[model samples]
Target chain A: MTDPAVEAAIARVHREEWARVVAALTRRFGDLDIAEEAAAEAFAVAVERWPRDGLPPNPGGWLSTTATRRAIDRIRRESQRMAKHQAALMLHDSTRPDPSGPVEDDRLRLVFTCCHPALSMEARVALTLRLIGGLTVAEIARAFLVQETTMAQRITRAKTKIRAAHIPYRVPSGQDIHERLAGVLAVVYLIFNEGYLASQGKDLLRVDLTEEAIRLGRLLLVLVPEDGEVAGLLALMLLTDARRSARVSATGELVTLQEQDRGAWDRGLIVEGQELVRERVRAVAAGAGPPGRYQLLAAINAVHTVAPSSSDTDWSQVLTLYDRLAALDPSPIVRLNRAVAVAELDGPAVALAQVDRLADGLDAYHALHATRADLLRRLGRSAESRTAYDRAIALAANPAERAYLTRRRDQLRG
Target chain B: MARYLLSVFGPTDPPASGGSSSRSELLQEWADTGAFNDKLQREGHFVFADGLEPASTATTVDGRGERPVFTDGPYLETKEHLGGFWVIEAADLDEALALAAEGSRACRGAVEVRPFNTPESIQALLDS
Candidate 1:
């Protein structure tokens, strides 16, 4: 029988040390498949032995050493010609004495590998959640709403491509780092979005996914402490996630920012997020570099968090940030969001004109229709508002969002 | 070093027949392609290069069954057909992709790069 303590230890180690163990093995073997297999074997061995004998003093070290040994053995067994040379290299590398244990952040290397631009965006998401987050293929498939076999094939293809393509197993440096960082941040934000507003589900929030994204953000903070953009991303996610409790009404309807109960917001996260935003903004002010898109976004979230109520929100400050954000990234979505702030400051008529300009590009986006509907209602254009509401309700994939839009449309009719 | 195949795909429809302007455009394209191949040779990235005839002229022989079956035309009906390919050696995928990007400009068509797997790497994957 497995001891409860041993089981708990295994679970904890899997959560905390899987990336490190796998990374160490991958570094040694230079193959993601071998590294993962070795790590799995090490965990299996841990389950068998840890219960019999008490847990090791350093579980992570123990796991890494065991997994490394397994990888070496596998490599040795596979190629008789290269066995002696490979075994010698593995033994020499594994036995090196270090006073400071596991000093290098192997997880960071794994993060860069998973987020490499060579792989497709879907592959990056799947690999990040699987390798870094320690989630199962089945779990990842469920999260993406794809067949387990499809996810498994995608992951296998990605690993094979990485090996074949020889995508380096290290954090990028120089100009490449800038491009790769965007991919990394995008993957993290995608995870948070999946949690914050699940693409297709009855519930508004998937706490597990949100918490996982936040955990990743925190981990990224530890790995890249000085990256203002990294801090900005973490702050953005935290500040936005802080309002999770207040984002849905007790009756399970989607609640807009203005209608949400401010008392339900997570004050601790707001404080932490606000502090991070201030530090990053201060760094920008000191001429580290111009504020990135994420930093400006985080600053906007910070402003919203500090406000007593939606009305108390500094529209002028929000407008300024939105203007800067629009300048940096004039994406349709950014302009759409800026229009909301414009509606508050310059009135709905002016905002409606801006929103109308975006109609062609953002025709399929539900938020675009929703924003237009809100502005039209304020302008007393009931017929146009009802039509816009219908479009939003039709386009909205989330059941909660669809329900909320439906209710609004019904109210307009009444 | 790894071997990569840079396959250039061409539109299915035959080239439009027009006057001297169209003929000159084709000549210019061929000249640009010749210059690209010369660059590849100078850089020592060239392994082998070849341009195929139209897919309509191709035949497929399947050996998966007990008896091999011969099929007419290309195996798959695709909008774009493999027009030509280059086998080049590179240290890694990034280098291969960079080379393929240059090849794309030369060929003036879409290029797909795929790596050839070694026996040992295949064994490693199978072992896992």
Candidate 2:
């Protein structure tokens, strides 16, 4: 007899593993609701029968198979109820292995669907978190620093938009693929930022979000092996994640790279990231295309990781990469980073000029003002730097960030 | 077997409601979540699930056995009120408790696990 304990265990698995199991099964079944319902039914069966039968050796796979069967049977039943339900049930018997082509194809399709352009950026994020990251509405809301009801509405809206628009759950082709790929890239970026700087919570970083973003980036790389930017993004995330071990202190205080213990960084992830960058750079060199933002960012990180110590950092090369990055993207943030590199490579005076030029665009950005203040103070312009420091303090978001900026301002005054 | 009910309580002060999304979008969310619940059912672990009406309509009753006295307040009056719940069967209290915890995590609400009285218990009461 299946142990009741085991059956209960399977039922719990159904709730936690529902999204993943459904995602994989839906790829086979081709209907969102059907796949979801089927997977749920499989869990229900687990609750009822698994206790008598005992736990299966491969629970996820078993759930997948059971859900798939349930989906087919559901479709058949629906057809009986409604004459309009004319679509054929995409059926594969429970015992057989899924064909590799459709399985692989379905994953790509799911990715495109989750990141579909038809959905707003917020909707895309909510959908991707729900479908791809397998997060519940409450978790997604917590991640976004919003109430659960608000997030639920957002996610529900996104799903409704997809359905009404009849957004096909398939990867785009031709010129459309380019647009969709950008959407995919944007989603990955959003995920990574949330991981890097959690909006709310005691911890500075959310490693789970970081890990999921990396996983998605890697998955994208696999889907489009020739896409240099995808690999670059993966490399960038890897290099950044590599430094996570040193990003916090023993007391959980945030540590800037300059003050970090380099020994704590993950050498394995760094090496892997470096290899990826090397491959992407070589491909870019072969006239595939100009290096994208991810490639440029990865190159900048590569500089930091390749150096044995902070003093060993090749500020000049990093400046050059930032220059290229600015030329390509031309964002206020990129210019601010460039100013920092210029401060190191040139001198505090030259860097101050760059910061002044960026000041107008980044007037409200705390870090930008802080950077300007640092350079001004170093250049013996104490009064001006103090003013800049005051501005930064007003704009600062967190206590640690404020403390760090305040300390610099104090040292300048001293 | 045991069953548990976990309710999610929203704030007592109702939110100043804003305009909802377009009808199509609202429908899609309903369809999507409806689909998700369907998955729950397929797993056979779905005991019972439903979203509740507003807590404002809730009525309270006290006393036992015969027709209990009725009141306007809830059964239990607290700042944080029960919103909704789920029922799941488990072998023992410990297992039931664990599932309840998971339910709490999923719903962000309190989960109370209680066993269903077996038929034997009814017969024992008659004998007594």
Candidate 3:
């Protein structure tokens, strides 16, 4: 094999086997730092030897064996210098032999451990991407717009906390799985949101992040097939992602949902997402009267996706679902979304009232100002609308959204 | 198995319970807590647990300098002060957290759980 072919093969296998190999190493070694370093060493060796020796037929198996040996070597080298190396060896006896870490999937155990609540939310997201998603520290740092050293420190601190605090490596038991799963879902959703709208940056959409989040969501579904919210979250992401291309105009301006061409939407993703929405809804109706927040959000997205045009959307259904979501979350963000539905059903004047009530709570949120600007524009309050658009454009980070808002502000009659 | 420190924190300005009925209520609270302590000891999770005196009684002592320094008020001044704490042994963080939850409910205050350092954690620091 040539160098390029070997590199490609190594990259492909690295993406496929990183989490599995690391998880297996962690399960065996009971130490994340060792598992991580050993995996890196194993990959480097593959890069060095695979070109000369030809790619191994069972690359993943070979990588796993090599990484385990590296970890063993690491422990031995360090153990020789320490006085209490015997005790550390016992501590490394694998954090309570899991009754298979629930499904014998090492990847699932790794994901859950990375998303443990003991770590800060940012740390959890960074660690999840690095450890389970197999993203390099530099890539994660770039994705989150943080310095490489900062991200490295964040990951290191989290690993230290996990070991020092004795966070178990196995998935939470039946009694605690639901509560723990919520934390894991929140981290994934945050990554998706960062990709969806993005922070203050030149790029409006982070395709890599949205893709990574969906991948994690799919993995979660396989690990916990019975979890309705897992299905709901995946559905919501897919439904939202279907409109990614139409979200930005060819001329480099943001396209609002009302302006996006529904004809260009991804039919396959829409179908998959709507199917999950149906399953979640049926399960929720049969079991509990109120669905989880993700389920309701997915249902709301289902209504929008089913509509041929924004005007044809079922505003009443969207409003009802938003109301339910507000009851559960009571967040200003939910009310802002609910106000969008109200704008369609009632007059913009009514929606403006709701948005105004949220002023104190969402003063710094760019979407709030954007929504208010649109409401004012619809009400023919040109001066107020112009002011609101200016506020939104100033607060907005995504260059596309800023350009779109800038055009709106300039278009208004003085 | 590991040891954890579950510290109960509450607002510094607790409502002054001076009336006779309030005093009896406090007594009843103490009785309930006493029963909880007994249960912990019976279950082998207890090491030591105690409620703290008011923060006003706390004095500060700093000995890092050549001569030790004594201050009048509590070492740390904050809106919320440590009201009490428990030193309990449990298997892993989940067990410790569960125990802290029950302890928090028993004392009617927020509890913060932290693990005591082990040989590995200390070695990790040295090795790093």
Best by lDDT: 3
**Residue A347, model 2: Cα distance from true site in angstroms:** 0.6
Assess each prediction's global lDDT (C-alpha) against the native: 0.86, 0.73, 0.88
Chain B TM for prediction 3 = 0.91
Q: What lDDT tens digits, residue by residue, belong to model 2 across residues A1-414?
A: 656577568646754466567667655554565665676578778777667777788787888888877876776775533222222123322423466543444556677888876567888888777776666678888877889999989876676544433456656766667766877988998888887876456567888788878877876787787778899899999999999978876765567788889999999999999999999888888888898889999999999999989889999999999989999999889888888888887899988887788877888798888888888888888999999889998987665566667777787754
List model 3 lDDT by residue over A350-398, tens digit each. 9999999999999989899999999999889999998889889888888
Model 1, span A297-389: residue lDDT tens = 999998898999999999999999999998999899999999999999999999999999999999999999999999999898999999999
Per-residue lDDT for A77 in model 1? 70
lDDT: worst 10-residue window of model 1 chain A? A80-89
For model 1, report DockQ: 0.39
Shift in Å, residue A62, candidate 3: 1.2
Instruction: Point out where model 3 deviates above 4 Å.
Output: A1-6, A81-102, A285-290, B11-15, B20-25, B63-67
